[model samples]
Target chain A: MKITFPHMGNLYIAIEALLSELKFDLIIPPPSSKRTLTLGTKYSPETICLPLKLGVGNFLEGIELGADTGLMVGGRGPCRLGYYAALQQEILYDLGKEIEFIVLDHPKEDFVRFKSQIIPLIKAGGVKALAKGLALAWEKLVAVEKLERTAHYVRPREARPKAATQVLNRALQKLRHTNTVGGIRKLCRQECDHLRDLIDRNAQEPLKVGVVGEIYTILEPFANLDLEERLGYLGVEVLRTVSLVQWLKNNLILSSLGLYSNRWLRINARGYLHASVGGHGLESVARTVALAGQGYDGIIHILPFTCMPEIVAQCILPNVSVDYQIPVLSLVVDEHTGETGFQTRLEAFVDLLSRRGQGGLQHDSACISWS
Target chain B: MTAPVYLGVDVGSVSTNLVLLDAHSLEVADKVYVRTQGQPIRTLQRAMAKIARKNQWQIVGVGTTGSARQLAGVILGADVVKNEITAHAVAALHVEKGVQTIIEIGGQDSKMIILRDGVVSDFAMNTVCAAGTGSFLDQQAARLGIPIQDFGRIALRSRHPVRIAGRCTVFAESDMIHKQQLGHSLADILAGLCDAMVRNYLTNVGKGKEIRPKIVFQGGVAANQGMRRAFEAALNAEVIVPRHFDVMGAIGAALLASETICREGATRFHGFEITESVYQNHSWECQDCSNQCEIVDIVKDGRIIASWGSRCGKTDSSSEYGMLGAGN
Candidate 1:
């Protein structure tokens, strides 16, 4: 069966490796672009978040490319994401597009149904191929994550503008082509070294900004309008507070083993926000506190327009900003976000942080009033 | 002696302002403000011509700010190109050394800047909405059959102001019409509109921020005494409007240009001759990729002096032009 799934940064590279290794015919949708956004918005319900709309666009592109089945993940949460697959299916069916959907949810919820859905996909290669595919996918995932971290480090410190991004892009292209585990490992090391070598150690200390927000907006460059790259270009070192590996480790391995709760996050989020408000609301608050404690120069909170959980987090973020004494700029983006305005806000925020760093505004304890 | 002057130009959606600051005394040598009238390049040229005719000063540095800053910077050869927020904050601090807050309502945007110890502590700009800004007020004034300059005076005559919706411009307009149909006096309705705009600005742009003493109100809208009175009444605090409130962004640009020239020791000012030059601008869709970015080119004397609006950075050649083209 020909399978297709939505893109989430480099997650596609790992998924392509796994599915191809499993001997299943796969059709990867084109990278998210204006056309994808237009198609998604045209078909999607008026108030659904950006991720779901993009997913529908991916499915449409995949279908046009002759893919007959769509693959997605399901979750149980207060977030609207849990209902996206069902809604997308209805949307596709109404559009007269026929495709089988395989939504992989937590196995504990329905082990029998999960096994039934998994058996057919693995029928060709059996459990051995499944294990091998999983191993290869896992290695590639870790490799991309490492490459991303190195890119973040080298971007601000690089002697030349866009040098680190160029290396990272070339490395990502190589990783997408290379299938062998050894090839991926060697590429990860060589490219990371190349990235590090581009840095000018004598460069002035760059401002450190932590990016905390919804997972989709944080991981998907198209979704956040390449925010990390923009910050890096502005001479700020970006520290991402969310990643695919961390999320999977927490939700899949830890939760399945009944050891899911993050003590650090729980402790950090106390007094400000108690209990999971669903999605990444709690995680956003906790990470902001953690980043502040780590002495980040500033924080940028991004969320897709009309995102419920993120809206909740956005409301409470001002309090956190005041309490932590860290400047936080919350940007809500959608298809309508103008690049010029977005750039202006980013540049202003950077200027603010740099001035704060220079102690240009002498700190007066008596006159300081955030409220 | 031709005294050195730093030039600042603010090219906004509704207006273009130019300020010349004397290098020795750091005082405003001259200022020119003109309506943009949907043509920024021409508006900039006219304002520059006015300034050029007034003085034969040596421009040592040039800065540009506002919505069309990059365009103005390219055409004028600016030493520093800054955003409106920084430009406004810099201007406010210069006007009032101990200013704690600044309320700026411009043509298409409004901003609230909170300063602590003379440094910008926090700021908020209206996002994805243009309610209660200068353009909206201007439109309402025209609809009321009164010159925009008289709106503030009429508003001041009202003893009892009516209430209008300020959440959105459409709602505000409809509510104003409804209030007018209810036989309310024109002065009361105008006063109510000012109050609504102030309420909207405070709720949206000034949300959650501390409004303290030494508040400086500036921008094109700051000229409207109605808005000034509304802000004062709402906050229960006196608002200080600088003498050159309308051209604050331009003044700040000049200040920033001076700072950059002091550090860099070189000027990129193309001179006032550009004001008399012939310039042409046009946009075309690039067919290189599916993105199909609409790239705009500013042609001076048959040579493309500046090109921008391309997402892929392929058509961006703003730095290539060192001087006006041979056509000039």
Candidate 2:
């Protein structure tokens, strides 16, 4: 059976490894492009968030490439994300396209169904093979993230801007062609070191900005307009609050084991937000608070436009900003987000952060007022 | 020839503004505002032509800001390129004493800037909605068979501004027509429109912010006295209009350029002679795949100087002046 899934920044690498190792034919959706966004917007609900539209767009592109079985992640929550698969199915059916869906939900409640759905795909190899395949896939995941982490650290510090980017891209291209797990790990290490070596230790300590926001927008570069890279290029080091590994640890490993709550996020967000308002609002609030206390030069909060949880979180962020005395710039991204305006605000925010880091208040804090 | 000057250019969809500031005094040496009329390059050229004829000052620094900032920055080799928000905030901070808030309305957009201690603290720009912008007023003025210049004076003559929906453009237009059909006075309808625009601005763009004292209103729409009165009545505060209200973005760009040059001690300011050169735009469908992406080429002096609009960055030669290409 041919399988396909939505793209969420390097997610395809892990999934592709798993499915291909399981001996199932797979179709990887092309990297998201403007065409994908346009198609998604054309078919999606006017008020639906951006990631959903982009996800639907990915599914369609996958279908065009002859992938019949669609895989999606589901959750029991107030977020509209859980309904994305059903809605997308309905949309595709309305357009006379057919693709079967398998939503791997919280494995706790639907373990039997999950086993039944996956057992057939892995029928070519038994449980032993399945376990091995997963192990290798997990390794690939770690390798990809490790290289990314190294790139992030070195990109802004490199004397030659864009040097780390070139290395990372080339290394990724190498990683994609490698077949064995050991090969992938070796390549990842070599690439990571190669990227690290590009950093100029003598370069100035660049301003560090914390990027915290909705999960999908944070992971998906298109949604945030490559915010991390842009910040890196602007001589700013970006420490993102979310990543696939962190998401898995928080949602899958920790939560499933009943030891999942983020201590710092919870403790910091105590007076601000009490419960999960759904769709990463709790996480966003907690993370922003944590970043503020940790002395990040600034915080960039990215939320897809009209996201319910983010909208709720946005209302409370300013209070956090005022209380912590840290500048927080919240950007709401949609299909029509003007890149020029977005870049302008970012540049200005960077300028503000740079100036503020140098102690903007010179009157000895005696005359600072919001008025 | 005069002392060295810093040139700032703001190229928006509706207008192109150029401001030349004296290097020493930091005072406006020359300023020109002209209709963009959909041709950003031509508008920039025209604006520069006017500035060129008026002065022979050596340009020490150059900056560009606005929607078409990249295009203008490319054409002019701006030392710094910023967005309208920062530009507006900088200009307001420079001109207005202890400025705390900035309310800017342009052709199709409006933004609110909140500043504390001469630094921009928070800001909001109208996103894809033109209900509370200058173009809407222009449309209403044409529909009402009244000159836009007299719109504010007529609104002041009204005894009351009939309540109108200030939500979306479609709703506002229909609501205005409905009020008109009900035999409401033209002045009352116009006044209601102004009030509706202000209400729209406050609710959408100015939501959740403290609209404090020392508020400065600028941009193309600031000339509408009716809109000014509506703001005063709504917030119960005075709104100051700067002398260079509409050209604040240009002025801010100049200020930013000046600051950059002062710190960096270098510039990429192309001379004013570029104003005389003609530039052409070209586009063609790239038959690469099913997407058939349209590649746009900005030609200068018969050279395919820059091309973009492709998903894959092929046929895109990152020219020396990266600012000129449609890099998006």
Candidate 3:
């Protein structure tokens, strides 16, 4: 079967590999653009969320390019994403695209059930093949998570980022070409050594900034204007709350175990001073408090154009900034964003943090809003 | 001795738009729109060449917006690359001069901008659905075997409108087909579709809070008269479609470039010759830690200008001037 998947940030590479390993020809959606949005908007219902709309466009584009099967992520929660696969199937059927849908639901309650559900999709159905696919997927996720965590530590330090980057790229290249678990482990260890050495030596300090926001934009750099690296190059250390590891822990470990308190508890300890379901509200406030407690310079919250969860967080962020006596900048990106205006704000914010002595503790209760 | 001009291009999935404006007056000199058809570079190049041929315009400042803004910005040598909300609001402010509450919908997406004074106070975007958008109308017209161009005119003639399940596109489609199969008049069905589009738009895109007047409707879909009438009925007020309704995004982008050009005397816009250049991309894997970063390189004519795609600085390191390029 010609299997296809939507472009959700940087999921294409790993997904392509996994599907190809299973002997299925992978059809990737065209890059997400206005055309994808147009296709998605043309066929999808108006009430679905933006992410789903984007996903629809991706799938539709893939079908138009001759895809026969759709691989989708299914979830279980208050967040509407849990039921998106089913929702998208109905939407696509209405659009007149006949395709088999494989929804990978949360393995929280039953791995056996989840495995059984997916067993039919595999041509060579057995525990051995399942084990291989699961192991490869886990390896990919672990590889990506380790890199993201190491990035946060090394982003601010490396004097010439290109040097550290060269080492990382070489390692990733080797990993992508390898198939065995032992090969992945060997490659990872070698890369880790190089990255650790780069961090320990030839590192500089400008400012350390923690980033907290929605899951997609936080982990997916393309959606956020490469904000983390941009800050890193501006000599800022980036501490991101969302990573592949954290996502795995949430969906696979904590969520399945019903241990959801870590998120809320972490936020409360950070003094978010509010409760929010999603859109990184509690996380943003908590990250700010955590950064403040650690004496970091500032926090930048990145959100989508029309996200309800982020808007709630954006509204409450002012209080957190005031209470913690830290400078907070919220950047909301849509289809239309000015390059110059955005750059100017970044420069100004960095300058303000650099002059933390401008008001110091006396600047307590001051709210900073920049456009 | 002559003032410079800035070219701004706003390319969306539904339409491709271009605008040319004077550096000093910020007056819009020219504006045009065309269906995007998935190839932004071709669409933009065609738009630029058209504007240039018409006015004999000099190459100056350039700005890009919409989803392909970055690609356009890099290809066209844009001095400024911005998002659609900022570009739209900037353009709206220019036209209305402190107008508040702008309702902008295109073929694929719709947005509600609540402007307080001249600044954008609150805004929401419809990235998820098709109910309140142009695509919904397009689908209905196709099902009714009527050209979309004439779909709106017939809608305006309807005395009684049917009910469409505007909650979702699938439900809405089935409802429309059932209405047709039941021998409902074309006019009523058309009107029903319009009402559904309007209702879905307001509930989904315009979901919360007060929707004040000074409502401006613009976009490719804004050309639909039925949609306009539906909005009027839904809001219980008149809906204003600007003179340049279809090309507002381009106009806004042009206005932004004009502002920038006024501040900076000369423009850095690379001439139209950049069209034929072959843009190439190659990927490599970074072996740094457990995270093997996949690095992508952007090359034009075998000369690499930029590279990115790793979570960290794995391949494309940060370039000077805050612009990212191949690992320095």
Candidate 4:
């Protein structure tokens, strides 16, 4: 049997190990990129959110590369991401791409049906095999958590940045090549520890910056133009909204915690800000709130232009800044967000923040001697 | 001193619109549209130059809208920057006291907006389709060797508009050609193309919506009488096209600026000199991590005014700047 899962922050880390133990072949989509966007845009209705298009592209690409089964998450949210799976399935079918659509629908309301559907996919010949799969999945999840924690610090100060990246890449390569949970865990820890050591020794200064935006853009590097590393270079420590641990908790345990009464939890104040109605703006607002609370110097809300939710947030962010006294910068990305224009804005915002940091705006600071 | 005027600019892919509204009277002083020939900066500069020459009023406030709003805002020193939906809806409200619907079709994009009272209730935009946009009609007009300006007049003359496939641009193009080869008159073919585009729009862009009759079609494509006829035929009702239809986005932006000025009782418009201001951009790659976010900077007077294009906030540490001395 073949089992596949959608790429979440660290979803594969846990499930891939278990699936491998069960002897199920796995198909993972390549990292998100413009190629994925083009693929999704070519097939998807132009009106849908960018993430859905990319997800569809990712799935279709994986399928073309030789997978019959595709796993997708189902959710209910204001962002309309909840409708993506069914719509994607319909579009894929229309495009004549045949695949087993395994939608892990919200298990709370559809618990019985979800279990019934999943049972067939599981290796059901023996209970021992199921137990082994569960155990392997657990190990993989733990490894992913550790990897992410180490990754959070590795970007800004790498003793040997290339070598550290090589370690992580080597671990991923080793994991992809092997089905054994133990083998993957061994490589991940070894690589992670080596990278962690490098990061720990080379740390000089860290700038603290907050990233807030739509779930897809914030989490998906390809979508957001990789803001984290840019800030990290400016000596910023990246505080992300979607962590591997939180992702697992949201998808696994807390998913059905309040399924009937509260289907969607307003989680991740650090990034999934809530300020706008239809776009990623609200999420950016929430991120601003969290960053302000954490005493971050500045906040950047990244979102696509014409995104309704972010637009709504943009309208309210000025007010949000006034209330919190946080200087919030909104970056509306599009196909035409040329790199030069983007860099200028980043440098200016950083300079603005630096000026503020040096007590330029503080009434009490006596440093302003008008020369 | 006389109250200053507010300058609003709407720069879309196909056209650049400029509007000047009197701050006190809130009346539109003047408005202009120029084709955006793949260069928004030049179009905006040219429009600003024209408005500056024609109107002797001092600019107190600047607002921007449409697709390249951010770029325009930076270039114009805009006090207010808004999206096309808000701008269109605002302009529609100014024209019609109780506009309930707004159908906007531009060169590269199309939108369906539902309004209640003067506010936008719901809206949908089509950005990734050439099938139901002005470009589609332009292509059809060229294929038939019909001047684009006369397409509407000829389409209105058609007694029996033929049916053409409209799901995809390729299919529609092929179908239009086949109908032409089948001895259909140019007017019939043009009308058929218009009908097909409208059909495609309703099915795809305008799907699952209650399109009320108190509708106003505004945008670059709203000037096309063929589309107006097609919409009228498709809905079996007359669709109102605003007088300053093509530049509604700019009008709405002007209205927004006017409203703000009314509330604040002052204008901070940088004036027409901004048109001559040097606007430049530069970029660098962030090698901080695996995700190499390209950082972009917008420069004015050799100083970085704005910087963005980062996924993780690594390159631009605005958040950290907020907290640097909080504890000290």
Candidate with maximal TM-score? 1
lDDT of 3 by residue, B1-328 (tens): 4446667799888778888776556677777777789877677777776765665677577777887676677678776666677677777777775467778887877877766555554556664455667776777678778998998899999999999988898898899889989999989988898898778878866755357777878776778888889889999987888888777777777766755555665666777777667777677877654345466666778987666655554355243312342111
Error of 4 at B220 (Å): 1.5
Q: In candidate 2, what are the lDDT values of residues B234-265, reduced to their tens digit? A: 99999999988989999998988887787678
TM-score, cand. 2 = 0.92
Using Cα atoms with residue i matched to residue i, what is each candidate's TM-score against the true structure?
0.93, 0.92, 0.57, 0.57
Off by over 4 Å in 3: A1-371, B1-3, B263-265, B275-302, B305-328
DockQ of each: 0.32, 0.30, 0.05, 0.02
Clashing pairs in 2: none
Residues B1-328, candidate 1, lDDT per residue (tens digit)?
6778989899988889999998866689888889899999989988888877767788999988888887888889988888888888888887778899999989888999888887788899998689989999999999999999999999999999999999999999999999999999999999999999999999998988989989999998998998899999999999999999999999888988888787678898888889978889989999875446667898987889888665445566737332111000
Rank by lDDT, descending?
1, 2, 3, 4
Sliding window of 10 residues with minimal summed lDDT for model 4 chain A = A362-371
DockQ of 1: 0.32
- Of the pair 1 and 3, which is ahead by lDDT? 1
lDDT of 4 by residue, B1-328 (tens): 4446778788887778888777666577788889989877778878888877765778877778776776677667666666676678778877866667789898887878766544444555663456788887887778778788898998899999999998899998888889889999988888888898999889866865568868888887888899998999898877999888888888778876765555565665666786687767788987765445567666777977665555543344242111111010
Candidate 3 docking band: incorrect
Q: What share of the true interface contacts does each candidate keep?
A: 0.25, 0.16, 0.05, 0.00
Model 1, which residues run further than 4 Å from truth? A109-113, A362-371, B276-328
Give the better candidate number (2 or 4) by DockQ: 2
Candidate 3 vs. true structure, TM-score: 0.57
